[model samples]
Target: MGINTLAFLLFFVFGITVFYLLPQRLKWPFLLLLSLSYISFKDIRGIVFIVLSSLSVFLGGRLFEKRNEPKDASFRKKILILTMIFNLGVLFFVKYVKPIYGAFSGKTPPELDKIPFFDSIIIPLGISYYTLQILSYLLDVYWGRQKAETNYGKLLLFTCYFPQMIQGPISRYGALSAEFFKEHRFKLHNLKFGLQLMLWGFFKKMVIADKVGPYVQRIFFSHKEPYGLTVVLGLIFYGIQLYCDFSGGIDVIRGVSECFDVKLAENFRQPYFSRSLGEFWRRWHITLGSWMKDYVFYPLSLSRPMAKFKKSLKKKVSRVTVNRIQIAICDIVVFLLVGYWHGAESIYWAWGLYNGIILAISALLTDVYAGWRKKLGVDPKRKLWDNLFIARTLVIVTVGWIFDCSKTALGSLNLLKNAFIISKTSFEPIVLNLVDWVEIAELIIFCAILFKVSRMKERGVVVREKIEALPFAVQVIIWVGMIQLVACFGRSSGEVGFMYANF
Candidate 1:
């Protein structure tokens, strides 16, 4: 079931209740059973996939731990390769096949009713996320960074923890495994903080993200030629909508884990405040970006071929330029893979390329930009310069969102062309027509609230702590008001699924 629904709430409630009541030793098994039961609602095959994948990784980890001698290094590498191929093969087969099949046949992928004996034949829940986790764990074991878990049950729980199975912050074995097995006594503070975070998530997803859905749909999904301003506005709305939806979901998941005294990693960090495309990625989807940096980017940069390429470039250019070129190549490759990670779509490729090019240019122009700023009497540390760069970065990011929102790469290119076409009609008429004046005002106010909170966070205000310190009645009022806001605004949106779930 979707994490936002009442059913999942009830499931979480029951699981947590039974969890703390049990003896310390039984906690892991109890949670394991609960996770299995929760996922089984999708279908039986999902359980099989989780079981087999877990087993494969478990075996791989064991092999690394057991055979990790200096002499058996090549065999350990073989084990790593085989494990990666098998798990990633499953993910590619289930997740990527449908897009390819659809392209050739011009029909939707066959569903459970059309196919036999495999109702859950679709990509098993969290395959994209958990596969990376498992891969990370296997790599760690092979590299001697961490020891593999001998306990299959603990490893299983680590792999399929229910809350993270939704949309993950992608927990690491070194960071999360100890937390998983630790005994947590029940605490009122934990419950209070967890519920508060979860409520905040509800407000973000239901009130803000879903509220702007129709405006975005109007432009992005329209059959008629879209207005230029309207398309740009739609892309802007989509960027906000996606951030709230994905980050909101992570908040809910983290909050749920918190109730059990488990701390999941934070996924976001005020990304809109970033002044560069590179900084924006570091803040937005922090876990995924960090994952690629650690597991993919660093290794690829330091690989033999890259080292050889660096040697060749060093002979042709200065050392500084060679380093910049090498880094740009790695950054571009990482972003291309990141884009493809979204889906097997050309539009996503364009989006990845767009970001990669911007980042590479930013790297290459560092000295030139610094000289220009110096010559122009621009202080890099001044607020005006920072604000200007932040706005510029937002505009660049929004343009990339056009590709993300479009159905195809060509459609995005057309939208970009149209955005600059400058039609005679003023944007005022289009804006007014999209919603009532009251809603238009409310939208501005809602965005203001979001911006104020995020800006405070950017300044390190510790908002939740401040709220906790307020008088009891004021705290209650705040909670009640937030719930009322969600109840009023959230109901009309019906069921709004998260945008990133497809990825």
Candidate 2:
């Protein structure tokens, strides 16, 4: 029941109608039952995820409470760490190892090795998401940033909130716990906003992302030696494909949550408009980046070795071990983990390392280059040059996506070589005349609309508010038009799932 599917639409409409009609006190339990039913409908194995996640949070909170009673913070920390490891371990095993083993060995594990009666472990939908959310909750308790939820049902609801159960902006316990217990009320404004956002998401996913998919798939799956220019174009298409797919999914999740009168975190902000890799990350998958920063990077930076390094550098060797260097190393390590978090594949690993290397080099040269420019009285902030630099950075980042999408290191290298290294005579054109013109036109129109929407968002312009203020008939017409476009162009086959679902 992916958010993009017709089944999800029906389920969501039914859930919303029942939720608003039910007594306030019964809403949580009703939703809980719905969640369970939804899970059962999708796959019985999802129940395992719900139970495991709920138990982990329930026990983790209890353990934290116990440690607090004894006043042994170290013991609590150890428990939290161990709990995280176990959760992640389970996640890793179910998501990666078993599949790889089955792929290679062509034999199932013995019954004794299996997970209870489930002949094979089915990594439930949003396991990675919920697991991370649960771990973050435990860690928050350990850090004293949030109190442990003693109520099992409330904690469970936090983990399995149906609106965010599948794809999430990864809500924190502190942020969502109160909302779970509070009485939800239906709001016309929220409903309107949510539906509008969902419509836009469907547009991005079904219209834009799916449209680009065929070109990308055709080139990548062809297994022919496509020319370098075509390969470059394919990589650019993939970058757009990923952005539209993942962010579009987030939009749908957010919109659905809004209909429940719950506000989920925004996952993306016009990331393509970012001027640097660091800035891009801040905008892209914002929830995950925020989690990694708060839970991983900050703690690691404040750890003994990094702290001592900062101290020693402040007193001596000022040029060698700067703050950026420290941050770059940490960024590299975090991104390496981020890369592998997608899957246990060499290509993914290399993709992570590639970004790490790029960021590290960028950091290392930043201060030196800035200083040199200042000494020469060159304004590094000049708009023209800044725009050029940003353009170059975008190209660099797009090239990085080639490695991310490629199946092997050699394949990535060959694509890059053909795209940039080979002479003109050796080039092989992949896009025939009419298709090329259509793609180019589509790309232009998409970019123009994207630019306008991005600017509007940046400016805090509420197009929806204006729409709502318009005559009801006008709004209905617009809605009808949106639906017509969706009906005509949306990916009806359901084979094109969200890109982030794989992660």
Candidate 3:
């Protein structure tokens, strides 16, 4: 069920309440049951796939652990390879088979109905999310870093943990397993803070994201073909919508889990505050970037071939230049995969390369830019310099979103070209033409609130903690007002489900 829906809210309330009342021994079991129930409710047809994937990882982990001997090294390697193939292959075919097939074939592939067991299901719910989670578990086990759960059901519970299944922070096994199996007691502080966080999340998603999303999408793709500032305005609105929708959903998920004293990995920092594309990625979707770094980038960067290349480069270039060259190569590969993982579309691929290339350029030019800045008497640490970089980074990131917001690479090019061109629509009240002034005003007010909140967070302010410190009656009044804001202005962020859920 969509987390933004009232029905899911009721479900969460009922589940958490019953969870607290359950016996200590029964807590995890009840949670497993609820998680499975959620899967069953979402797509009964997906039961077979989820079971097979989780069970394979669980058994693979057991087999790997048992065969931990020098003599069994070859066997262990084979097991890991086969298990990864099976898990990833299923994920790929289940999720991308149609688009990928059509991409090459130039025609619609045979209907999925012809495929066994996949007839009724397209992409299985959480298939994209849980696949990475389980793979991380399998890899950790293979590397002898973490122990596999002896009980298959417990491992299954970890994979199907309901709160994070919708759109994940892509948590690691060691980090989340403790939170899952820990002895959790109900605390009034958890309840208060959790609810407070959820309220803020609702404010972001309903008050701003949902309100801005439709209008942005309409203007962006409208036949009137918006240009210049109209395009710029749409891009900003889209950026806001994307962040608030994804992060707001994550906040709700985290808040609910926190109610159970289960701490999920955080998915976002103040990403927009980042002054570099590298920093933006590190800050945005914090878990996904970390996952790629740990699983993809580091491994590739340290591979024997890379080691050889790095050694070869040292003979011809400075140590820093050698590292930059290695970084450029590995980053290009990582970001390409990152893009393809987002979609099979050329636009996504281009966006991925744009980030990878820009980051690489920034790295390669680090010394050059610093030298120029020094010569120009521009202190790199100056506030003006930092703000200038921030602005530049924002523009770069927003340009990448044009690719994301478009249907094709060519479409992205058109949008980018028009995004900069002067036209009659450039200074017009184009957004007001799209929606009423009341909505425009509401968006302004909410966005200003969002900016203030984000600024405070960037400075490490705990806004929720501040709210918690308020008098009980004052807190009640605040909650009531928050609820009223959502009630009156909410566009139901989940009316169409979260944007990231598609990925």
Candidate 4:
């Protein structure tokens, strides 16, 4: 169910209620049972795949832990490699195979006709998320950062934790498992804080995202080719719709975990205020970016091949230049993988390559840019330059979104071509098609309010805590008003599915 919907709300309420009601010893099992039940709601195949995958990783972890001594390190590495191959192999077959198969064979391969329930089987919910989580867990064990869990049930619950099993701020084994296993006594403050976040999420999803959906649809899905302004509007609105939808869902996930006294990693950190594409990535999908940095980028960059390459460059360039080149290469590779992680489409690959190129150029030109800024007497710390950089970053990010939101690479290119050449100057009739002038004004007002809140957060103001310090009655009234406003204006385009959930 969509997290914003009543069904999920009820499910969460019941789950948390029973979780707290249970004795300490029964907590893990109860959660495991609940999680399995939740997965079963998606597909029976999902349960089987997740169980088998979890079991394999669990076995891999145990073996690695056993063989992880200095003498047995080689064998432990083999186990890690085998486990990664198996898990990633399963992920590929389930998720990517269909698209690859379609690209080659016009029709379904006749070979599949022999397998039992092959047609019925599909990629399960949270497969991408949980696969990464499991991989990270196993890797952490191998890296000696965390011990492998012997308790199958606890590991199972960790993998299938219902809240994060949807869209995730992907958790780490070392940081999250202890909180997962802890007994949480209900507290009024936790309840209030969690509910407040959840309410904000609902507001973002139902009121903001859903309201903008029609306009985005109109522009992107037009029968005739859309003009420059329409395409630009579509890109901007899609960015808003996507950010609010995905981040809002994360907020709901975090809030739900909070009610159980489990804290999730923060995913977004005022990404719109980011002054550079690199900084934007560091803020946006903070967990995934960090995960990639830890698991993929650092290892590859530090590999013997790269070390040799760096040594070769040492005689030709300054150490600072070498470091920049190394970082740029790693960043590009990570972003390419990040793009591939989004989907099995060429569009996604192009999107990743697009960002990679931009970042690479930015890195390579850092000296030139700095010198130019110095020549122009520009201080980056000054407000004007900071805001200019933020605006520039947003424009770059929005251009990237064209690739993300379009149907194909060529389609995105066409949209980009149109974006540069304005064909229509008047947008009144176009905006009127989806909404009235007054509603447009209201939308702008809502955006202003969201911007203000984001700016407050960017300044490191603890907004929720500030609210918490208010009088009890005033807090209640504020919360009640939030609920009432949502109830009055909230709308959903039937499914209410999160954009990232598809990934």
Candidate 5:
């Protein structure tokens, strides 16, 4: 069940109650039970696949460790390779196999139906997320960063921890298990903080994201094709819709997880305010970027082939040029794979290349840009300079969203080209005639609040702590008012699901 739903809320209330009531040892097993139970509610097929995936990696880790008798490195490498193939193979089959096959065969595969495993092409919930966690665990064991888990249950708990099992701030075993197995007392502050975070998430989801989503979908998919100024408006709203939907869901998940005294890693960091495309990525999907950096980018950087290439390139060019070229190569490859991770869609790959090429150019031009800025008497600490970069980055990111929001690469091009027109959009008549001005006003006020809060966070203000510092009665009244606003506005948002859940 989605965390936003009433059923999941009730389930969570009950589960948290049982969690706190249990003894320390039973709590984790009970958590495992809850996770397994929750996934079963999502799909029986999901539960079976997750368990199988978990077993494959868990066994691989154990076997790899065992092969370390006299450190038989080759056998361990073989085990690691086979294990990666099995796990990544599953990811590829479920996520890519259908689209790739459908492209070639021009029809759905009967072979998939013939497989006895699942009834239909049902991709498991959080397969992309959990598979990353599982691989990270196996790799950690192989690298001797940590020992393999002797108990499958504990390992499974790490693999399928419910909150992180959703759209994740992907965790590694060494960092996560320490938090997982530790003792947690029921603290008033933890509850207050978590609930407050959840409330903010609910506001973003129910009020902002859900409200804007329909408008975005309608405008993007209209029979008239993409609009002009309307296309700009739709994409701008889409950016807001996407961020709140994904990050808001994450906030709810992380907030609730915090009540258990386990804080997941931060996923977002005022990404829109970032100064560069690279910085935007570093802030947005923070964990996924870090995972790619550690597992993919750094490995490519240090590998022997890259070493040889760097040497050859340095012979033809300056060392600085070589480093820039290296950055270009690695960033492109990493982001290309990352794009493919989402799907085999043309738009995704185009979006990936778009970002990669810009980031690479940004790297190559850094020294020149800094000197130009110096000559222009531009200082980054000044407001205008910072805002300029922020605006530039937002435009770059939104341009990528043109790709992300469209059905295909050509569709994206249509939107971008249409975006330049000054003519009246056909969608405006519908917007004016049918739109609710009251709801629009509410959106404006809430958006203002959201921007103000984000601005405060960017400025290093701890907003929740500020709330806590207010008079207790005042805090109660303010919270009561905000909660009521959410309830009132959110009711009209209907049951719009989190956008990233499809991934």
Candidate 6:
């Protein structure tokens, strides 16, 4: 079930109640069964995907365990790598190969159509997320950083936990497997906090993200030439839509996990407030960034070629210069992978390359710019000036959102041109008439709430504690207001699926 649905809400409440009433020893199995039931509720065929994911991890773990043997280390590493490739291969084949093959061949592939009707390959919900989690687990096992879980159910549950089974913070096996098996006692604090997070998530997704959806869709789908202000506003709205949609999903996932007394990793940390692309990566999709750093970038940087390049460069350059070069190279590789991870499209690749180039340039010029400012006696630490710079940087980043959302390179350029050069008269008749008073009102309210949350986020105040400090009457009123708002304004025509679900 979609996270933002009435059915899922009922399921969550029922699951939580039954889970809390169960005996401590029975909780894990109960939750596992509940998770499986939930998956089955969505599609029975999903079970096949789950089984495939579980078996992949199970075998990878077994192979990793054998790597400790003196005579088998080399063979085990090879097997581990092969296992990872196969797992990723499954994900790639299911999600990408057909579309690519059809695009080139002008017809659907016979092999894809030949699968049994019952077992026809549909991309499983959260395959990308769970596969990454399981692959990381296998890698950790191979590296001796974590022991392989002996229990098959725990491994299965880790990869298919109901709350994060769809979109995820992509929790590591080491971080969550033990907790999955542990007995959970219902804590009043956790329940209160979880509910509060759920409320805020509803506000983000239903109120902010959904409210902006029509405008974003219209701007992107329009075949007519766009006006400059319309294009700019479209990009701005898109940036807000993306953040609310993604962070909202994570909030719901984290809230549900908390109800079970499990703490998932935080996925967002006010990414828009970041001053640079480098800082933005650290804040946005934090779990993925950490995964890439631990498993990819660090290892690659310490590999023979990179290490030798660094050593050779060090002999001819200053330490700072060498460091910058290393970071630039690593940043480009990581960002490219990050882009490719999003989709098989050229647009995503371009988006990744764009960010990488920006980050690389920023890193390369940082010292020179700092020295220039120092020479001019400019103080970057001044709050007012720093805030201005932050605002300007945010605008730049928002404009970049056009690239992320565009369907093609030419489309992106046209959007940019419209955003900067077109006169309002060209499209004023069509665009100006599309504005809705209700949506505009909702957008204003959402902006106010977002600003409040952003301020709380900046001050290091916990959102849960803030909500708890309010009187019971106030809390109840807030919840009632949110429910009413969602009922009144939530998209009702059709399912407004989470945007990141496609990934």
What TM-score would every model get versus the actual structure? 0.96, 0.90, 0.95, 0.95, 0.95, 0.92
| Clash pairs for candidate 4 | none
- Tens digits of lDDT, candidate 6, 301-343: 8889998999999999998988888888888888888887888
Consecutive 10-residue window with the lowest summed lDDT within model 5: 111-120
Assess the local accuracy of residue 422 in candidate 6 as a C-alpha lDDT between 0 and 100.
64
Which residues of candidate 4, in runs, are more than 4 Å off?
A: 105-118, 424-432
User: What is every candidate's alpha-carbon RMSD to the true fold?
Assistant: 2.0, 3.5, 2.3, 2.5, 2.3, 2.8
TM-score of 3: 0.95
- Computed on alpha carbons, the lDDT of every model, listed in order, comes to 0.83, 0.78, 0.85, 0.84, 0.85, 0.81
In model 5, where do residues sit more than 4 Å from their true spots?
69-71, 106-119, 425-434, 491-493
lDDT of 2 by residue, 271-349 (tens): 8767778888899999888988888889888899998888878876564657877888888888888887787666777
Point out the higher-scoring one by TM-score: 1 or 5: 1
- Per-residue lDDT of candidate 3, residues 85-153 (tens digit): 998998888767767665676654466456565454467778878888899999899888899889888
Q: What is the alpha-carbon lDDT for the whole of candidate 6?
A: 0.81
10: Cα error in model 5, Å: 1.2
lDDT of 4 at 31: 77
lDDT of 4 by residue, 1-503 (tens): 76766788788889999988998888778878888888887776788888888888899889988775699978988889999999999888888876666556554545554446456548887989999999999898888888999988787877888888788878888788888787778798888788888888877787788788777877777665666677778899989988888888898889888888888899999899999999999999999999999999989989999999999999999998998899889878988999889887778888998999899888988999999998999998899999999999999999899886577778888878877766455354375575566766767876786788898998989989989799989998988988986787677346578878888
Q: Which pairs of residues clash in candidate 6, taking residues 3 or more apart in a chain or in different chains?
A: none
Best by TM-score: 1
Candidate 1: which stretches are off by over 4 Å? 104-120, 425-433
Q: What lDDT would candidate 2 get against the real structure? A: 0.78
Clashing pairs in 2: 228-418, 228-419
